[model samples]
Target: MTRSVALLAVLAVALLTALSSIFIVDERQKALVLQFGRVVDVKEDPGLAFKLPLIQEVVYYDDRILSRDLDPIEVTPLDDRRLVVDAFARYRIADVNQFRQATGAAGDQSIAVAGRRLDSILRSQTREILGSVSSNDILSSDRAALMLRIRNGAIRDAEALGLEVIDVRLKRTDLPRENLDATFARMRAEREREATDERARGQEAAQRIRAQADRTVVELTSDARRDAEIIRGEADANRNAIFAEAYGADAEFFQFYRSLAAYRASLLEGNSTMVISPDSEFFNYLKSDLGTQ
Candidate 1:
């Protein structure tokens, strides 16, 4: 019985030693082997790896890209316009030794610490760079260029933290609520002023058109009156010439015709009345048989 117990104890010790000597590294993970709190090995390959049991420890970090959304921060641009900016960053751990050294911790704790540091660096850079440009630049096509600059600046500073900043992007940018209200009001006032100016211009044009029309009407009326007066004068002169020619050709006949015309004018109206002596020239036509002939 004593010999059988000794063999079982040796088998049990071997199983425990075998289990403790081996560790696994997944495809998505990178591992660091630390001996007595000092990093001794880095395992980047997947599958099984061997280490001294109870003497070495393994720390695994994700090898995939990670994303972080920073909090919204307020900034003022060169134009003195205030804005609230929200941004996000994409990064990955590029150097395990540097990451370990910078974070001074392992796994999740290290990632948490790195995140805080990254936030600080990104926030500072965002403020500095954004503050140097005009608000119009932020709101224009140059926005892409500004974001690129921020990403480059972040990558430069993140290198010391063993983080490779792949990209940094602005998620949202907007004015403060009070500023937005003021801007809207200003825009409305400007539109109103433009509308007023347009109306005044329209009125001025209408007045000009009316004045032109009035002038044209006065000119046309004056021309029509002048033409009528000239035509009347010509007709009167023609009548006078015909009368003179008739008188020159036959004075007796002309006198007889003139007396008849005068008699007709004085007696044509039913209510017309005239008083004259029988010897008057106006009565000569009425009394003479020559008028009838």
Candidate 2:
């Protein structure tokens, strides 16, 4: 019985030692072997990894890329325009040993510390670089170039933290709430001024066109009146010439025709009245005999 118990105890001890000596590293993870609070080995491959039981411990970190969204920070540009900028970054632990040394911690704590450091770097760099340029540049097509500069600057600064900053992006940029109202008011005023100027110019052009049209109309009316008067004068002169020619051709016949015309004019209206003697020159044709007079 004593010999059997001793063998079973040995088997139990072996099982515990074997279990404690092995660790797993997944395809997406990396492992660090720390002995007595000091990093001794780094396991970057997948599958089972070995370490001394009860003396060395394993710490795993994700090898995949990680993302962090930073808080919005306010910055002022060279034009003295205030803007709130929200940014984010994509990073990964490139060197596990360096990362561990840099953070002086392991696991989640190290990641958190590194993230905070990167956040600080990004905020400071964003402020400095963006603040140096004018607000118009920030709002213009040059924004892409400015963001690239910020990203590059951040990548350089983030290297010390063992972080590979793959990409840095600006998520949002806007004017502060305090300035929005004032900005809108100023813009409205500018538009109003422009509209007023446009209206003034339009009215001036309209007036000039109207004056030209009026002048043209007056000239047309004057020409029409002058032509009508000239035509009337010519017609009158032709009638007078016909009358003189008829009188010269036959004096008696002309006098008779003129007296007949006068009688028709005076008697055409039923209410018309004329006072004259029957023997007067106006009625001589009516009083005399036509064949012998």
RMSD of each: 4.5, 2.9
Candidate 2, poorest ten consecutive residues by summed lDDT = 284-293
Give the winner by TM-score: 2
- True-vs-predicted CA distance for residue 163, candidate 2, Å: 1.6
Candidate 2: segments with Cα more than 4 A from true spot:
1-13, 101-106, 276-279, 289-293
- Report the number of the highest-lDDT candidate: 1
Per-residue lDDT for 1-293 in model 1, tens only? 99999999999999999899899999898999999999999998999999999999899998899998999999999999999999999999999889999999999999999999999999998999999999988877558888888999999999999999999999989999999999999999999999999999999999999999999999999999999999999999999999899999999899888877777777886787667676776776566677643
Question: Candidate 2 residues 149-243, lDDT tens each?
Answer: 88889888888887888888888888998798888999999999999999999999999999999999999999999999999999999999999
TM-score of every candidate relative to the true structure? 0.73, 0.85
Q: Going through the candidates in order, what is the number of backbone clashes in each?
A: 0, 0
Instruction: State in Å the error of residue 109, model 2.
Output: 4.5
**lDDT values, one for every candidate:** 0.92, 0.90
